[model samples]
Target: MQKTGLLFGSFNPIHIGHLALANYVLEYAPFDEVWFVVSPQNPLKNSEDLAPAQHRLAMTNLAINAEPRFKSSDIEFSMPVPSYTLNTLQRLNELHPTHDFSLIIGSDNLINIDRWHNFRTLLQEHSLLVYPRPEYPIEKAVIALPKSVNVLNAPMLDISSTLIRKGLKEKKNLRFLLPAGVYDYILQHRLYQQKKE
Candidate 1:
């Protein structure tokens, strides 16, 4: 079975960091493809802070267009608001029974894995590919990780969608922060130029 890694995020605007991580995982991991699962809203995040789901999805698609192994999935857009990872994984399994699915997360998320809905069950049923995040040392964690988790020393970037948005709003020199097409899309749409009301 082909292995697919799911990277779930709001992707308010997709950036090079997101692409780099996914590309690095594809090169190093057993995954044949990596899907950018664009969530409409994370349960922990404020929905009002998000770009329109369609725009976010579009940006993700634009960011990954050149990579055949990278895909953009709006799986949570049609689902209920504040989608859970467990639910998305189950649904993907049901939809694509032939492929093996793994959840891609950062070390920070691994630290808070228990907070996820049905997290224990999710861990038991699916493999997790964890990458490094600054200040969240996976090696020093006190929590006993399950056998299903694989930690990778993938490259970490200090860039984030939040940072990109702030930079755009402030007219900072954020060139190369995003893919050329994605940055062009954001500028074309005039997104993140004004302060939020």
Candidate 2:
């Protein structure tokens, strides 16, 4: 049976950090493929700063073009906005019965997992691979997570999409922060650039 891992997030512009996490998970864990499930809108975030779903998806594709193990998905775009994790997992399970699915999340997200829609049910169904973020504590998160959670001390970079956007707005080069193709795409589209006062 094929084992697939789901790395769900609002990949505003898929950065090098995101790719690093995915690659690390694949290397450390037992998964055939890692899918980048791009969320349309995160209920907990402000949508104003988010780029259009299509644009984000296009950028994600460009970012992952060099990695055969990384696949970009727009499943949430087809579903309702502010898509819930439970629903997405259920749909994926049904559509690909032959593949065993696991959820890959950051330690920070695990701290707020209780707030997600039907989070308890989500935990029961899917195995989880939790990675550590810059400041988040793994031990503290491990105490709160269910038994299905697997904590990974994989290599991490202190880069974020928010930081990348800020760099773009300031007209700064995002040299190693994002994939070369993705950086070029952002410049070509003038994304994240501040409007003239």
Candidate 3:
């Protein structure tokens, strides 16, 4: 079975941090491919400042265009708002029965995994590839993590889409923070620009 890592995110603009982490996971982990699962909306997060799903999906597609092992997924676009990971996993299994899917998430999310919808069953049925976040310490949560979850020593990228959007709104040049073509796409679409009052 081919192991696929599902990195779920809003991917408002899909930056270098996302690509770098995915690449690092592929190199150091056992995953055959990493899929960028672009979310339409996160139940746990506010939708304010979120780019349109089409734009987010397009940006994600642009960022991973050159990488064969990387894929962009819009599985949540047509699903109900506030999409749940469990549902997405079930859908993927039905669509691609041969591929083995695992959740790729930051340690911060792992610590709060219980808050997710049907989390216990999600953890029991699928594996997780957790990477470190600067603020979240996995050691404290080790006792709570399931046996199927594995932590990777991949580089901790502190970059975030929130800061990227802020920088763009502030007229800061953040091209280096994003993957090739993504910055251009954001610019061309005038995304994340401050709306004049």
For residues 89-190, write the lDDT of model 3, one tens digit per residue: 999999999998988999889888878999989989999989999989997563477789998999998999999999999999899999898888898999
Lowest summed-lDDT stretch of 10 residues in model 1?
44-53
> Which structure is stronger by TM-score: 2 or 3?
3
Per-model CA lDDT versus the true structure: 0.87, 0.86, 0.91
lDDT, residue 2, model 2: 81
Residue 24 error for model 2, in Å? 1.0
Backbone clashes in model 3, listed as residue pairs: none
Q: What is the C-alpha lDDT profile of model 2 across 91-124, one tens digit per residue?
A: 8988889989899998888877877898888888
List the lowest-lDDT window of 10 residues for candidate 2.
137-146
Ranked by lDDT from best down, the candidates are 3, 1, 2
Estimate the TM-score for candidate 3.
0.96
Residue 130's lDDT within candidate 2 is 90
